[model samples]
Each structure stands twice: as C-alpha cells, then as structure tokens.
Target: MADLTGSDLTAAKAQDDVAAPPSAPRRGGAAGLVRWDTAVGALLAVLLLCSFGFVGDFGNTLNLSFLIGNTLPMAVIALPMTMLVAAGEIDLSVGSVAGLSGAVMGSLWNAGMAIETIIPLCLLLGLVCGLVNGLLVTRLGLPSLAVTIGTMAAYRGIAQIVLGANSVTDFPQQYLDFGSGRIPGTFLPYAAIPWAVLAVIAVLVLHATGVGRSLFAVGASAEAAWFAGIRVKRLRLSMFAATGVVSALTGVFWVLHYASARYDNATGLELSVIAAVLLGGVDFDGGKGTLGGAIGGVFLLGTLENTMSLVDVSAQSQTVVTGVLLVVSVLGPRAGRQLARTVARRRSAGSGSAPAATG
Candidate 1:
C-alpha cells in the first residue's frame, strides 16, 4: 500500500510538470494575441473609421487617387526609413538630401540639361551623400545620431547654396503633368502607382528575402550578426545608400507635384518621416517592425494633419499633437511589456503555490 501511494504521487508530480510547460506556452500565446488584438487592431480600426468619416468622399475612386498621390512621397522614403530604424539607426539627413537632390535636378534642368542627364546626376549625388554618412558612422566609429545631425544641417545648407533663395519652376511640362496626372478615367493617381509598387517591393524585401532576415538579425544584435558571417558594414552602407536614393526620388516627386523645387522644400520633414516610422511600430531601439505597420502609421499621421487643417488648427498646435502622439506610441509598448512581465510573475507564483495547497 505504501509503495503504491508513493508511485501515485510521483506520477502525479510528473504529470503536473509536463502540464506546466504547455500551459505556460498557451498563456504566452494568449497574451501575444491579446496585445495584437488590442493595440494594432484597435488602432487600425479607429483610423479607418475616422478616415472614412472625415474624408466622406473616401468612398469615391477619385478621392482614393488623391490620397494615394499625396501620400506616396512620404511612403517612398518611409519604406527605407523603416529598414534603417529596424537596424537601430536613424537618418535625419533624408529631408535635406531630398531638398538638395531636388535642387540639383532643378538647377540642371534650368541650365538646359536633358531630363535623363539630370536624373542620373541627382541620383549619383544622393548616393555619394549616403556613402559619406556610412563612412562617417561606420568607418570612423561615430555615433550615427551625431553624424546624421551634423549632415542634416550641412546638407540643407548646401541646398540653399545651390539654389540661393531661388526656385526652379521651369521643369518640363511632361514631368509636371506626370506628377499631377491620374490614370485615365480612373481616379487613381499615376504618381501613386510607383509608390504602391515600391511599397510592395519593400514588403517583399523585408519579409520574403534573405537580406531582410539579415537586416532583422543585424538590428537585433550587430555583434551576433557579424559573428554569424553577415557583412554588417556593407549592409549598413547599402541601407544608407538606399535611404539617400529614395529620399532623392521623393524630392523629384515633390518637385513634380508642386511644379517647383525650392531649396527649402521639405525642411524639417525628417521629423515627420521618423514619426511615421515609429508610429508604424518600429522600435526606436531596433529589431522589430513591419512595413504594413509603417503604412498604417503614415495614414494615421496624414489623416491627423488633414483633420487638423480642416479644423483650422495652428501649426504650433499640430506640432504639439504630433509630439504627444509620438511619446504615447513609444511608451505604450514598454508599458505593455512591463505589465506582461508582472502578470507572468504573478501567474508563476500562483502555480507554484497550488501544489503546496493541495499537499
């Protein structure tokens, strides 16, 4: 009888141990589902509802075209920005780079340069700027934040020097029309097509490709990535170059849409771009984000701006709202993590005590 009782107790204890592991996993899965459902899902639903309400014409095809057209420039740059942030870096010089590239294109055009010539030169200039940034940060072992901040000021200054308080408005009529034109008879803006395509490409690169996986690995831990044979420096340079090229492209798009390129175009836009990146769910510290989240973030910020404009909000007030939103978005994740840890601890304690009580 004694031996039987001992065997029964041992078997029950083993069963409980086995059950604990699976239960812990289930709880973890449940917590993740709850977090996603509560945070991302709820935020997205609210944005959709608000967008439709505010832009009543959102249901119309033309309205969709307009939204896409207006949003594409930001989207283009934001895609690469997402990648950069995922790798735990920031590029404050993007807006300045865009401004400078636009100025370069505009200046070349005004000098009677062919569109083909101007385009390639502008792209090259962007590439060079990116290269410099990568060299300064990686090769020189400087903090990216400091280096980019300096470059941001210098690049904008260069743009000003290139344009010298003048604006270029003599772009080819074809280019201007391309910027403003919609797809024939559909409200779909032609400008948006490129952006949409790029977004899809970006999604594929980040989610489907080995390079994307490498980027995540690098962002999660650069030393680990290097140890694993990833070319960390090369990847960083490539990312910087990609960012520059996209920013330049965005500059061209801006010039085309507005029919002019001023040295000051997109000034202070880096903040807006970064905000969109963070709002999209990229961690500031790196290693976690999605392009879809960034897209949603773009819509959120764009809609907020549009709404505020409609309500006659001051620029200062708008800035304040943005600042507040950024703070909340960033801090929200941390708070959630801490809460989850606390709950986990409590559950663990409860489970440990359950056997004691039964005994």
Candidate 2:
C-alpha cells in the first residue's frame, strides 16, 4: 500500500468515525412511556392520591365518569388547538365558536329543522369561522393573536345576540340520551367515547402523517419552511379550520349532554384548552409537543378540577390554579435551559482542567 499522507489519514479516520459512532441508549417499555411527560404524570399521580384522600366516593367509577363527561369537550377542542399551536397559531375564539355552534344548532332544532340539516350546518359554520380566521392571519397578515382575540369577542357576542339570556331546550330524545348517556349500561360516558375516538384520530394525523410533520416544521421555523417550499399559509388556514370544526363538534356534543343550548355554553373554555395543551408539553413558543402529552395534560387538568370541585374549591381559585400551572409550564422549560447552560459551563471547565491535570 502507498504511504498515507496526513490529509488522507484524516479523511479515513473521519469516514470510519461516521460509520461507527456510539448509539444512544434506548429507554425500555414503561420507562419509555413515562419519558414523554413525566412531570405531568407525577402531578396527575399526586392529584389522584389527594383526591382519594379528600373526597368520599371519589374512588368510585361514577366519579370518574363525571369527570370524563365534563372534560371530553375540552379534550376534543384541545386536539385541534394542539395542531394550531404546532403550526404556530392560536384560536382564542374556540369557546365562543363552540357556544355559537351550539346556539345555532339549538335554534334550528327549536325551529323544527331536522337533525341532518342542523349537523351539517354546524360543521359548515365551523369551517366558515375557521376560514375567516385564516384569512385575517394569512391573507391580511394580521397577527393571529390579535385576530383571534377579536374573533373571540365577536363570536361570543354573536352567540349572545342569537340566544340572548334564553336557552333552547327541545332537543330530540335521541340526542339527549346519547349526549348524557353512558356507554351501553356502563359508567363510561358516551360523550367521552366520541372525544376519545377523535383524540386518537387527531394524534394519528398529527404524529403519523406528512401534513403533521410539515405543520411542525412551519411552526419551528416558518421562514425556513417557506424557503423549503411548504405552503405555510394554507396549512395554517387548514389548522384554524380544523380547530373551528372540532370546537363545533364539541358544541354539538354539549347540546346533546345538557339537553339545553345557551349562549354561555363552553364559556371561558379557551383558557382551559390552551392550558391543557401547554401542560401537555407543547411549548408556547411552538413546534414541540405530542398528542399523547396533550391528552395527558387534559387528564391532569380534569383530575385537578374534579378533585377541587369535590372538595368545594371555588371556581375562582381553580382558575388561579390553572393560571399558576400555565406560568410554571412555560417557566419549566426556561429553567431546564438554564440548568443545561450551567452544566455545559461546568463541563467545559472540567475539560480545561483535565488538560492541566494530564500535563
């Protein structure tokens, strides 16, 4: 063989290293599952324990059913909210949209429209609301935060205008039964079943599809994505539409469950949905979260609220708790970043000192 020169030796070594670098250790089954949002899980476990200790009958499945029933609508809305956030947008109008959709459906039903017409009409309304949001943000170049804030007020106002203080209660028995009904004589709520199914579908779409990956990419870096030929505007619009549609679905479910539709339906729910998404490990800055984590966040919030309610905690205090959690969730990542920097500094110092020690 010919004598190896310095450059040739360097190149050979680089190629070999690239071919045979050490593999990172893999987490095993249970540990792997817990790795996604260990913090959320810990909070949930502690809440569960406290709930059992403080509330009589909290251990029963019926209590769980009640919690599930209440939380299902929020969960459904949050799924699409997760996608919107992942795509670097937010929809503050979801609560109002949900309310409006329910009001519309109720009004139509009270007027004797068939269920078929009401359902499609509700879905179409969602699509329209979402499209408007998308237009304001994407076409007009308005900030989504501002646009959604305006729409939140506008939509809720529309809901009030539509129903005033009066409520629509003459829903068909089939809807009422399905909405408030449990699953086939079990304590499992029917409302929760649809939400669960929707959550699974949303998760699969967000995690297992190309569109999902692209949404994340756009959120992570919109300019970069645009340069890479992704249609950032269209995707953002679609996500907003999806959020509206999901919120509408939840609204319909609400009408079914309560047997009444009112302007106040799902009021102030936007915060809870966003809280669940953030607590689930989706960064507020965008482009990082899992559907499973969002679901976990929903469960965490649901448990906290249910436990609090059982103990007679005031709604105001619960809001405070959610606000605190939101702050902590955002801060936790910052704390981690600070800790990483500290560790990196120490490691650098150690490596520098190592040279002297060897010398």
Candidate 3:
C-alpha cells in the first residue's frame, strides 16, 4: 500500500491511484446515502403534511394536479440526470437541451409539419445534442461541468436562433391536456403516467441491476471501475444521451403544459432539477445517491414552491430559496464524506497496529 499523506479525499484519491489504491469511500460511499436518504424522505413527508394542514388550497385536487403536472418535467429529466451524476458526470445544459427541443418543436410547427412528425424529430435533436456533449467529454477528455456550461449557452443560443422571440401556443388541445390536465376524478396528471413509468425503469437501472452498480463504481473511482472492466466511457456517454432524450421530452411537455413554445421555454430549469436531486441526498460527488431520494427532493421543493406561490411569495424569493438549498445540498454531502474519510482512516490505522493471530 502506498503511504498516503493528503487530508482531502479527492487529493488522496489522486495520489493513491497505482500502488494498492485505497477504497477511500467504500464503507459509507455515495455521501452517506442511508442517513441522508432517510433524512430527506422524512423531511419531505413532514413538509407535505404541514402543507396540507396549514396551507389553504394546497390539498385541493386542482392545486395538487397543477403541482404534479408542473413538477413532472423536472422530474422526468431528473431520472437520467441522477444516473449521470452518480456516474461522476453532469450535463448542466439540460435546461438548454429542453429549450432547444421546444424551439425546434415550435419551428417545425410553424413550417406546417405534423405534430407527430415534429415530436420524433425533437427527440432526435435532443439525442444529437446529448451526443455532442458526450463526444466532447468522452472523446476530448473535457470536464463535463465545463463542457455542459459551454453547451448550455450554445444550445440556448441555437434555440433562440431557431425560434426567435416567437411563442407558439396553438398546439392541439389533447396534447395540452395530456401535459397539464388531471386524470378523470383524480388529482394525478396524465403526463405523470409516463414519468412514473420512466421513474420505475430508472429505479431498476440505478438500484437493482449490474449497470446501476457500475454507475456507482464509475463515479466512486473511474480508473478503478475501468480497471474492473466497467466500460466507463461508454456508460457515461449513454447516460448523457438518455439525459438528452429525457430533456427533450421534457421540453415537449413544457410547451404543452404552458400552452406555449418559445426559445426560452424551461429556462434555468437545470438549477431546479439539480437542486432537487442533490437535496434528495444524491451525492454531488458521484457514486452515491438514490433515485427515491431524488424524487423526494423534487416533491419537497415542488410542494414548498407551490405553497409559497399560493401564499403570494415572490418568484425572486423562491429563486433565492432554491439557490440556498443547492448550496446546502453540496455542503451536506461534503461534510459527511469528510467525516467518513476520517473514520475510515482511524480504523485503518488501528487495524495496522493490531497484533497478528498466532498460528
């Protein structure tokens, strides 16, 4: 084993790569998922109960439907985003990808194309957008954070060029209903059905299958995962593509839900998705987090925001709250990881000083 000196977990990881790499975060990996997951889940439940009891109009079927409907787009994109983040990467341009999808949808609609024809093309466009980001990161070895930031701007710019300032609101009524309308005699939105189905698939992929385990391995230690034959690059690339498709799908839903398609549709939504996901206890550092936690975070924030709105809290204040939550999520995981590393190190030192068993 290599003698490790660094106190920083990432620095230690960087230093101890070759000679018996230390599993720096194996014991409580993924940012102390069990603790944070349970914490966030309980918090969400409390928020819902309190909101129902205290907030007027929040428990009503109409408001509940609106809340779920509005949240589905962010939640949909979050499914793939969680996988991507857990695999040690992120696409900050998801909101932009969604915007581009909406822009393209509007442009094609203006060109008298069939809505059915336009939807597939929009999805394909998102795929291409994601592939471009993937290729840039995988092939060029660029950081995903930086790459997505650049692409976020570029994608939004292209969306603006494609749709300008125009708002397309003439989409078919049925599609709009599917986007925002509640199910008959229930509060569930029609769009939630697809999101639920996708959520189940994501849960299976992230928690139940080998690929899910691979995602954690890759995020935990890309080099180790690669050495262990995880096909790291391909897995990350596919996750990005999946994120793109979902973002595009969210864009379509955004347009339909709001009864408008503009270049700026879903603008700044990446912040909300990421905030909700991290708040749900998915470690921002990768290799740690649960899909269920991410979903809980989504609803918690969603319900909080909706309740705030019903009570006339300003949008600016809401944004501030979101920003603050994002900061907390990032910090909470880092603090837990630091503590975990310290405990693991002490345990290792203790074991090293222990007497060997006599044969």
Candidate 4:
C-alpha cells in the first residue's frame, strides 16, 4: 500500500510539471518596446480618423495621392535604414548618395547615353559607393557615424561637380509615368507598387530569416555576436552596401517623379528616415525595432506633415513640429520603461506582504 501511494504521488508530480507552460522571455530595455510599437500604430489610426473629419479635402483622392508620393522617397530609404540601425550602424550619406545618383543620371542623359544603359550604371555606382563606405568603416575600424558624415559631404560635392547646376527633365514618358502616376480610382501611386514589394521583401528578411536574427544579435552585443561565430564586420559591410543601393534607386525614382534630375535631390532625406525609424520604437542605440513599427512611424509622420500643409502651417513651424517629435521619440520609451519597473516592484512587494491563508 505504501509503495503504491508513493508511486501515485510521483506520477502526479510529473504530470503537474509537464502541464506547466515554458517561461517567456523577460522584456529588457528597448526589447520591451514591442508594446510601444503597437501603441504607435494605434495612435496613427486615431490621427488618420481625426484628420479625415477635421481637415478639408484630406480624404479626397488627389491629396491622399500626393501624401503617399512625397512620403515615399523617405519611406523607401527607411526600410534599409531600419536594418542598418538594427545592426547598430547608420548611414547619413544616404541622402547624398541619392543626389549623386540623380546627378549621374542627368550627366549620362546629357551625353546622349541610352537611359537603359545609364540606369544600370547608376545602380553599379551605388554598389561602389556603398563598398567605399563599408571599407572605410570595416577595414579602417573607424566609427560609422563619422565616416558617413564625411562621405555625405564628399558625395554631395561630387554631385555638384557632375551636374553643375543643371537639371535633366526629359526622360521616356513611360518611365516618367511609372514614377508619378497612380492606379485608377484609388489613392495608390504607381511607385507605391514597387515600394510595397520591397517592403514585403524587407519584412521577410528582418522577421523570418537567419540574417535577421544575426542583425539583432550584433546590435545587442557585437562582441557576443563575434564570439558566437557571426561574421560581424562582413555583415555590417553588407548592410552599408544595401543602404547605398536602395538610396541610389530612390534617387533614380526621385528624378523621374519630379521629372528632373539634379545634384540636390533628396538633400535632407536622412533626417526624415531617421526620425521615422526612431518614432516607430526602433532603439537608436540598436538591438530593438520592427519594420512594421518603422513603416507605421513613416506614415504617421507623412500624415502629420500632409495635414499641416493643408492647414497653412508655415514651413518653419512644420520643422519645429518634426523636431519636437524627434525629442519625444527618444525620451518616451525610457520613461515608460521606468514606470513599468516601478509598477512591477509595487506588485511584488504587495504580494510578499500578503498574509498566508488560514489552515
């Protein structure tokens, strides 16, 4: 009878253990901001609803199309910039790279080179520009921020040299139409189709692949990632290159969309991209962000700017608004995290102080 009783107790214990769920990962630092990302999405939805009701013609098709079209240049660049930041790096030169690519497109067109040939060459230039930035940072062990700042100036100067105050406005009508047209009876710009495809590719790469895991790992701790056999430098280099290539592509699109190519295209685009990424809850320090959140941030800013424009807000006031949001993005998460920790501590203390149940 005793042996049977012991066996029964042991079996019950084993069953209870098996029934327990596995422990979930504790949120830490920026990693805890996953909830924050969702909050931004919700806020964006609310803002859109309010705008449609309060702002005149904001719901109309033409205004909506302009909003998406103007926002796209920054939005597309934000995609790769998110990944680069995820891996704990940034490329300020992206705007200049866009400008340089456009300048080259203009120069080649002026030389009577076929548009087809010039495009491929422009893409190749992007790869080369990216490689140069990657090499400087990876090979020389320089800080990426400093290196990119230098390159930003150099690239823009080269753009000036290439196009020399001239703009190229003539391109094949078909290509121009693709850049600036919209689908019938919808708010979707034709350029948005390609951007949507790229967004999907980016989402898959960041959220569902080994490469994505490695980026978070590196951003969280470069030394640890290296110890775990990740090719840290190689990965960083590739990310820089990706930023370059995408920015270059955006430049080409910029030229066609505006029907002109010049040295100064997308001059301050990096600011918008970085601002949107951070506002999306991507930790500026790295190791935490979602592409979904980043994209949400993009549209939020775009919408706000569009509404402001419709309301006759001065350009300087809009700049101030963006600056204020930038400040909030940096501080909001840290404050929320602190408040959460305090609440958790209070709960723990209250539970500990509770009296035991009567026997």
Candidate 5:
C-alpha cells in the first residue's frame, strides 16, 4: 500500500510536469511579442477601404492603375531594404545609386550603346556601387550609416555630373510597356511582376532558409553569430550588393515608366523606402522584422499618398504626413515595450511585498 501510494504521487508529479509549458522569452517586452505586422496589415486594410469609399474617383481603374504603377519602384526597392534592415544595417545610397544607374544608362544609350547592352552595364554598375558600400563598412569597420550617407552624396553628385541637366526620352516601346502596362482588370503594373517575384524570394530567404536565420542571429548579436560560425560580414556584404542591384533595376524601370531619364530620377526615394520598412514593424535596431510587415508598410503609404492626392492635399502637407507616420512607427513599439517593462517591475515588487507580508 505504501509503495503504491508513492508511485501514484510520482505519477501525478510527472503528469503536472508534462502539462506545464515552458515560458516564452520576454526579450523586448510585450511589444516585441506582439506581431506588428498583423497590426500594420489591419491598418493597411482600413486605409484602403477609406480610400476606395471616400476619395472621389480614387476607385476608378485608371487612377488606381497609375497609383500602383508609380509606386511600384518604391515597392521593389523595399524588398531588399527589408532584408538589409533585418540584418541590422541600412543603405541610404540606394536612391543615389539608382539615379546614377539611370544617368549611366542614358549616357550609354546616347553614346551609341544598345538598350540591351546599357541595361546589363547599369546593373553591373549598381553591383559595384553596393560592393563599395559593403567593403568600406566591413573592412574599415565604419558605421554603415555614415558610410552610406557619404556615398549617397558622392553617387548623386556623379550622376549629376554625368547627365548634367539632360534628359533621355525615346526608350524602346516594348520596354516602356513593361514598365507602364497593367494586368487586365487589376491595378497592378507589369513592372510589379519583378517586385512580386523578388518579394516571394525575399520571404523565403528571410523566413525559411538557414541563411535567413543567421541574419536574425547576426542582427541580434554579431559577436555571438560569429562565435556560432556565421559569416556576418559576408552576409551583410551580399545583402548590400543585392540592394544596390535592385535599386538600379528600379532606376531602369523609373526611366522606362516615366518615358524619361534624368540625373534626379528617384531623388529622395531612400526616405520613402526606409519609412515603409520601419512602418511595417521592422525594428530600426534590426533582427526583428518580417517581409510581410514591410509589404504592408509599402501598400499603406502608397494608399495614403494616393488618397491624399485625390483629395488635393498640398505636397508640403504630404511630406509632413509621411514624417509623422515614420515618427509614430518608431514610437509605437517603443511605448509598448516600456509599458511591458513597467508592468513587469510592478509585478515583481508586488510579489516581493506578498512574501514579506506572509512572513
């Protein structure tokens, strides 16, 4: 009887142990645990609904088409930028690299290079630009922010020098069509095809692969990732290069879509891209973002801009709106995290007081 009773007690303990789940890590507090992507997604949906419902002619196919097509370039750049931020770095020079690529293409075309040849050369130039940024940061141990900032000015200046107040029209019609054409019954442009493809690729790479996991690890702690055998420098370098290439491609699309190329093409584009990425809930500090969230961010801004344009909002006011949205994006998560910490501290104090009272 004694033995059976002991066995029963052991069994009960084992059952309780089995039933209890492990606690989740509270690294960044409640906000960290809360998926910002879902929130951003909901926000996007509401914004879209409001636009379609309230804005005059905003729901018309032609207007919708133009909105999507115009914004496609920014959307495309946001993909690699998402990964770049996920890995805990940024490339401010993307806009300038894009502008430079466009300038180079225009110059090459005028200098008797075929459009086909000019395209590849432009892509290569973009890759080189990326490599420079990556190498300078990784090798010289410079802060990416500063390095990219300097490069941004340098690249944009080069672009201005190359094209110098000149514009290029007369791109091939078929290519132009690819930029401006839309799918039947949809506002999505054919230029969005590459964006869609890259977005899928980015999703898989960021969320699925071992390499993707390494990016998170590196972003969280570079030293730890290095100890774990991840090549943090190589990964970052590759990402920078990828961003450069994609931005250059966006430049090409920009030229074709607008039927013109100028040195100022894609000016101030970097801000919009960064804003969308952060708004999607990708932490500026890095290692905690999703491609889906970033996409939601892109569409949310695009929708907001389109609606505002339809309402005849002033350009200055639109800029202010974007700035406000970016500030909110950064602050919202931080506020949540702070609240979580405060709650945790209060709970700890209460628990401590309860023990003393019992004593």
Candidate 6:
C-alpha cells in the first residue's frame, strides 16, 4: 500500500466535508419526518382537543371558520418567513409592507381605478419595497435586523402618510366574501385553498430541492456556503423580495377579508409571525427549523387564542401568553442543543478513557 502524505489527507478531509449533507433537521429519506417540530404539531392537536372538551362553542363551524380566516394572513406570511429565516435573514418590515400595500390599494381604488389595476400595482409596490431592503442589506453589507427595523418604521410611516387617518371600506361584496367566507358545509375558509397551495410549494422548496438544501447551508454558515460556491448574497436578496411580495399579497387579502382598508392594517403582526415561526422550532438564529413546525406554531397560537376567547380569558393575558411562548421557543431549542452537546462530549470522553484503561 502507498503511504498517504499530509496534503493527501487534508484534501481527503476537505472532500468529505463537501460531500456531507446539511446538518439541519431533515424531513425526508429515512429521517422518518418525526422531529421536534412534529411534537409542536402534536401539541396543536392536543390544544384542539382541550378546546373541544372545555370551551363552549369552540367547536362550532362558524367560530372555527372565523378563527382560521383571521389567521390566514399570518399563515401566508409565515411561509416566506420560514424560507428567509432558513437562509439566515429576517424581515421585520413585513407588517409595514403589508400595511403600505393595503394603503396603496385603497388609495388607488378610491381614486377610481379598477380593482384589477389596483391589485397588480400594489403587488409591484411590494416587490419594490422588498428590493429596497435587499439592496440595502446585500449592497451596503448592513445587518438585516437593523436594516429591516429601519424599513419597518419607514414603511409604516409612509402608509400613515398615504392614508392619513382615513379608511376605505367600500370594497365589493364578492371580493370580501372570498377573503372571509367559508366553503359550503365546512369551516374551511376559501383563503385556505390558496394557503394550502403555497404551503405545499414552500415545503418542496425548503425540503425537496437544491435551493432548499442551499438555504440550509447558507443559514448554517454563510461563509462556508460561499466558499462552497453558493451565491449567498443573491439567495438572501431573493428571499427578502419574495417575503415582500407575499406580505403585500396578504395585505390585499386582508382588505378583502375585512372589507376595510386602513393604513394601520396588520399592525403588530410581525411579532406574531416571528413568535409562531420560532415557536414551531425554527431557530431565530437561522438554519435549524422545519416548515411543518412553523405551521404548527401558527395553529397553536391560533387555537390558544380561540380557546381563551371562548372561556372569556382577557386579551391582556393572551398577550402575556404569547410573550412567554416566544421566549420559550427561543430558549427551549438552545437549551436542548446545549444539553445534547454536553452529553455527546461526555460520551466521547468516556469512550476514549475506556481505551486508555484497556491499554
């Protein structure tokens, strides 16, 4: 056998590293799809049972429709938010973007443009807003958190200025029904159909495709992904833009659902989105979450809210509950990961010392 040189060993190690799959939680191919996120989803099911068992009228078709309908917008935004977080970025400006898009939509509709025209324009404006955030982050090399915070305020301020304490509530009834209406004989809202399609797409993109795998790489370590030939900056920019577009679309849906358009629409929604995403097991720091978990987080919060309202729990207490969940979501995974590493280190030490004793 030929002797292996140090350079050959180094090259072999590098190759092995390159060939290794991403260390993020897997959803397919022998991973069996059960994970921490699955546990959260199961919790959602438990909450539903409790609601049915205890809360009066909680299982009624009308209330269920309203509950799911109200949550549709947040659920829609959560899809793109998952991808962005997985790619190691965040868009705090989404709520503001949604508000601004709604404001623009109302203004244009009130100015006598066709709703069709107004909708497309509003979507384009959302793309522009997202692109601006992307440019500032990727081109200026700014931190996404700081950049998005600034844009969040800017977008909301612009929305306020554009609509200025006025609301447009004269939308057509057909459109309104589409936003908030339920399917015949069922609690499932019409909005759910679109959200379902989007969810499936998000799952495929995040779990079944090369782009999804690349996002895991980028989130785990951008520098390493870049060295491995991924276009980290471009990928992140695309994520921000997609977030903007989806958020704006949700804004349109919100106006229709409520049959009201106000600059303050979707106010404080970013917190809920973040809380649900993180609570579902997507790490706030990026690179370790699943779409299933994120979706479950959204439903868990929704179910909790429904149950509280049914049992006459005050909104103030509900807010506290949300805050606690948010805190726990971030801390829980981190604590678990730390404990896991500690156990692993101990096992390694024990194995090595056993060999020493045998020698």
Local distance difference test, candidate 4: 0.88
Using lDDT as the measure, the top candidate is 4
Backbone collisions counted per model: 0, 0, 1, 0, 0, 0
Pairs in steric clash, model 6: none
Residue 358 in model 6: lDDT: 47
Clashes in predicted model 5: 0
- The estimated TM-scores of all candidates read 0.86, 0.86, 0.87, 0.87, 0.90, 0.90
Per-residue lDDT of candidate 2, residues 29-146 (tens digit): 2322344477677878888898888689788877878888888888889899989888888999999899999999978877889998899899899989989998999999999999
lDDT of 5 by residue, 123-226 (tens): 99999999999999898989999999999999999999999999998788898888788887887788777778888998999999998999888888889999
Question: How much does each candidate deviate from the true structure in C-alpha RMSD?
Answer: 5.5, 6.1, 5.5, 7.4, 6.9, 5.4
Q: Output the worst ten-in-a-row residue range by lDDT, candidate 4.
A: 19-28
After superposing candidate 3, which stretches have Cα over 4 Å from the reference? 1-34, 339-359
Give the least accurate 10-residue stretch of model 5, judged by summed lDDT: 18-27
User: By TM-score, highest first, what's the ranking?
Assistant: 5, 6, 4, 3, 2, 1
Alpha carbon lDDT of each predicted model: 0.80, 0.82, 0.87, 0.88, 0.87, 0.86
Candidate 6 local distance difference test against the native: 0.86
| Tens-place lDDT digits, model 1, residues 1-359 | 67766755665556556555545433544334443323554676786687677756555676566666766677789999999998888899999999999998888888898997888888889898888898888898788899999999999999999988889898888889999888898877788788888889999999899899988888999999999999988998899989988888888888998888999988877888888778877888988888888877877777667556555778789899889988877876666555555556566555655664455
Return the clash pairs for model 2, or none. none
Clashes of 1: 0
What range of 10 consecutive residues in model 2 has the weakest lDDT sum? Answer: 20-29
What are the per-residue Cα lDDT tens digits for candidate 4 across 192-247? Answer: 98899999999999999999999999999999999999999999999999999999
Query: Can you give the lDDT of residue 84 in candidate 1?
Result: 92
Kindly list the per-residue Cα lDDT of model 6 for residues 1-359, writing each as its tens digit.
13434544454445434433332223122222347788798889989988888887998999999899988888999999998888889999999999999999999888999998889899999999999999999999999999999999999999999999999999878888898888998999999999999999999999999899999999999999999999999998898899999999999999999888999999999999999999888977778889999999999998898789888999999999999999988876666555554444444444445444443
